[model samples]
Target: MATPVLDKVEAESAASPYITVTMRIRRFNPEVSDAVVWEDFQIEIDPKERVLDALHKIKWDVDGTLTFRRSCAHGICGSDAMRINGKNRLACKTLIKDINPEKPITVEAIKGLTVLKDLVVDMEPFFQAYRDVMPFLVTKGNEPTRERLQTAEDRERFDDTTKCILCAACTSSCPVFWNDGQYFGPAAIVNAHRFIFDSRDEAGEQRLEILNDKDGVWRCRTTFNCTDACPRGIEVTKAIQEVKRALITRRF
Candidate 1:
């Protein structure tokens, strides 16, 4: 039995699919220096593993000082959003094999926000924009004894917008947001859309009015970068267009 176990271990070792890949990371530590620098680390990892796994390897084995935010390793938490290979993506969802591993993979923090540390950015401004849109379903009058009812068609009206995980990938990818931090961004608009089209929500007019601000929906340039960056495959640009149409016609 001991010999069989040893043989199995040897066979697994021989079948290892590890490859040497260089992870190019943008390093910034305000406590140490204001200047941002790019550092490269050569790591041995399986291509099928996630980029987050590489970061963990570098932080655990190479440099313990590496700092970034992550809650659930799964993509649902939306905490590990970052720039991978010049595009915004969830680190855990991006597989190393999917991106070209022959070249150095670049990792950095999302743009248009204050960088707190390596791969970490201040999300207060992002959240403030989200709050401005009033993402929660707003109702008037007394509380209902039962849940608000809606037709299947009514629910489908805003189903696409409801998939938003608030990852900020769609927002951070926008060039308008990159230049102007005041822009409410695609994620905020998508959240507003979720409530605006809901049949049971009575605050559609109010949310639309809020989004009609100078820094609101008009800032979108329709570059489709938001749609391309969304990991959830949400039609972000279309939703923005729908909001624009609603604004003009005053109809939901």
Candidate 2:
């Protein structure tokens, strides 16, 4: 006969269950071959665990060679951005339970960037375009010892674009960026927008001039891909539109 303590232990164990998750990642290694390959990993994990955790288990326990980037796993660093289930997202921000575990979760490097290894990509070109836009405050004259004061309305003007963490999630998701590597991507334009509306920044016109080039805001077709792919909830398409309007109306 089963004792009462043994029956209670069995009941408690039955209350907790873990789901089997399958991750199919697209891998590339220049040292090995030009051809890409799909690798599958199966692990038992809690439904609420993040995709980054799954990748860690595979790298730590299954294969030490598997590669990816991650920092500040809570998702502020944006280091773990990748294509998950046909969409660009931060792996650290994506929860396994949010996406169905019944289907295999597909992970790949963000598009439009050259894959350097299994999940790492060549961010040089991405950063190169970023540098072209001058993503910084440009104020002339002597620096003020006191804080530059602005009205609350002025601060709110460009606050939406300020949430970007330079993750490249929006840029890589853009169809325009995928086709032309030279185009200044949405991330660049969004950064420009952040400073363009500032009441104190004196270089708004200069940044607008740089973006007025043929490869600038006009290239954006308003596909809404960048807006959807941004992990920080920034209104990317609206900011790009505002930049376009600023050119015509010359108003912030």
The candidate scoring highest on TM-score is 1
TM-score, predicted candidate 1 vs. hidden true structure: 0.93
Please, what is the TM-score per model? 0.93, 0.93
The per-candidate count of clashes, in order, stands at: 0, 0
Candidate 2 Cα misplacement greater than 4 A, ranges? 1-14
**lDDT for position 252 in model 1:** 40
Candidate 2, 1-252: lDDT as tens digits:
999999999997787667899999998888889999999999988888899999998999998988899989888998999999999999999999998989999999999998999889989888887788788778889988999889999999999988999999999999988997777999999999999998889888988998998989999989999999999999999999999999989854
- How far residue 58's Cα lies from its native spot in candidate 2, in Å, is 0.5
Model 1, residue 200: distance off in Å is 0.7
